[model samples]
Target: MIFFEDTVSVVKVAVSLLLALASWLLIRFPAPFRHYLNPRPALTLWVSFIGLRVIPFIIVYLIMDFAPRSDTEFFYKKAIAAFAGKMVYRDFLSYHGPLFGYLISLPLYLWYNAKILIPFMAIVEFAIVWATWRYYQSSRPDALLMAVLYFLLPMPFVAMILSSEEDIWFWGVGLITLAYASRAQGSLWIGIIWGLSMIVIKSMIIVLLVPLFFLVDNKFKYVLGLAIVGIPSIVILYLLMGDAFLMPLQHSGYNMTPNIVSITRPFLSGVYNQISLTRLNTISLCITMALSSWAAIRYRHLGYRQIFPSLYVLTFGIFMLAQPSAPGFYLFMYMIVVLYEMVKIEDRSFNVQLILLNFLIVIEPIIWVIYVGMLNYDDWHTVFSSGVNTADYLIQVVEVGLLLALVWRTFVHLRSLDRAASQSFAASSQRTGSSPVS
Candidate 1:
């Protein structure tokens, strides 16, 4: 039995590696296959979308029974309990927002079995693709690519859908919010409601509202819409749960720290130990906020089209690093935004970097498993052995490098737009023999 289990683990790892390799190759050689892969016809587009998104999800769902149990089981148990009149905070200690437990409980209402939950989650995945398509005004090919990326991208598939983390729902709703918020002219209520819904799902998502606020035309309506939903939700939760309502707030402050920090932990020795995790997290948060605020203020003058990419970088990019735990799925939304922007600007270099970064992230689990020798290794020393620690360190270095590259590219893109606008104004002034400003 032990040998058979070890063999199964090996097979799983090998399959995961091959999948990652295939995705890397496909991304690396997208052009040669674009003729066939890119959807030119409406029928082809829809077919490709279904094939890319639905089929893989179905396969995962079918095999969910055979897959190793994870936090999803714990969440499913808690969600079922919540449905049985158990309060999230009072009945059970939960680090997550109250709504997440309730949200996961939704699938249970439809079907009692946990396996059925996979298909429901797949539907949410489809919604994410739809949201991405709408948000970016994606071409058929682009939409198909988004679906493929979301489905096959190992981290998203493994950590989110397969593991059944509520982050997937958070991401789906967040994208929907972006879809509505990105519109130039629309009812602000929809965007505001979705935005608040995202926050209610996970309060950490509140950072995203900063960019959403700038995306829409009517700031007052947007803010009012948020207040409309947010104020009442808080009041009701407070009235019902009282002190338990503060649990999410309190939980947010606890510094779980990232695996990436372990890379330096050994080298710095006593020096690293001396610095408070709370202080480090606070400093990181402040830096992220300052940078995002500066960008928002500077780019507020641009048109909605131009402003969207900057807003993505400011909100999602900062949120990626600001969080205590560095889950790769956190980058899923940012990856979509970056890909959309990259396609718009035709920045192939940055696109390649993004794909490579994703591939690296997806493969980290392999190293993690090899170093730790199983998914549930509890000892800190075993989990963070020299090999795994070094691998994590390198992965984080690459992540940081890719992120900086993306930020630089965004800056360059914005600067080029500014230069073009200025040149157009200069030419118009020369033709008219007077400047409108003067």
Candidate 2:
């Protein structure tokens, strides 16, 4: 069922996938690797982690000089354009945040090449791994296990090694939110940081910011802080770009392939028919905020410090699920933050689906980019424009199903906390021969 006659391409895809599947099998049970992993020096671990992110792409694309996977790395071009004294929305058609154009491009100024972005992204990812370990330190996650799965997982691989995607900026705001909540610091710094994050990263931080307003204890202060920084920063941006400041924020209307919208596109019209970006963004935004607000209320009983896991996961997970713009790689951040929690779940069926979900999501982009439209993995425009064939469509159906299952599993796990609390209360009441609290 290969569309185009590319044996070499098939081999490349097959070998990479098979190797991932094998490594995933190892993830099912990491007990045997513990003796070896636990004894390793921390330096060795860090070096190995960095090596995994860089080496494969280095050999394939850097040394052998394969055709670039897609124009993902060229995102620095937005930054590059701004550095050369061009206005963002007027001088160039870019979907990135206004300041992000400058933020990512700063590396290119130092070196003046896209390869500079590779190292820049590497540093960003290294910080992410370090952040993952540091934030979960009290939970005492198995460092080696975290690194191994994080390494083997295809989501980050697709982002870092295959194509240099900047969607990890999703993690930037996400991690910032986590740190702010974990510390329970009532400082106005978060409002400032979040303000900076909106302009510096994608405006999707608005999604994270909404639930965060309720999840933290400092609601009034948070609101005051946000206004202090966010309001004027936005005003300045509007003044600078005019209505064009809304351009990047409105970018989500162009559906990224392999999202829920892709599944529905064929039915709405022909694959090429342009749907209303405004309508799609409005509907998805409403869905994202409604679900996130509900999740905030659900986790409100827990202290801010304790609400990070369920709150962040559900809020972001639903946002990713509901949005037409979020690519499968967006889930790259989800697995890193939630993998340890998924691993601890005792349900074998859920664990198996969790592993497959990670694997399928990596393939999600591949199927959309390579398989669906006859290997048109050349540019984001072409890739998103491509239509799904029957084979690829079937695969997306399964991916969506698995996503629903995992999100439900996570919700159930969170609900159990409330159940346990209620049970403990009832038991205490009974022991004291008192009326059980409703």
Best by TM-score: 2
Let me know the TM-score candidate 2 reaches against the reference structure.
0.84
Alpha carbon lDDT of each predicted model: 0.58, 0.66
Q: What is the lDDT of residue 284 in candidate 1?
A: 60
lDDT of 2: 0.66
Model 1, span 1-438: residue lDDT tens: 112345544544455566566666656666754677554534544564466445655665565445425666666776787778788777865666667777777888887767655566556665665566666544444555554554555555555555555554555565555456556544366456654664446666666566556555777887777777777777877788787866765544433222334344545546645766666555665666666656666666665455655566556666555554445456655665555555432445655576666666655544544443423222346345565555555665677667666666776666776777878889999998997587
**Cα lDDT of model 2 by residue, 102-207, tens digit:** 7777787687766666667767876777676666656755755675667666556656765666665665565676566555455355666776776676677787
Task: For each of the candidates, give the backbone clash count.
Answer: 0, 0
Residues forming the 10-long window of minimal summed lDDT in candidate 1: 254-263
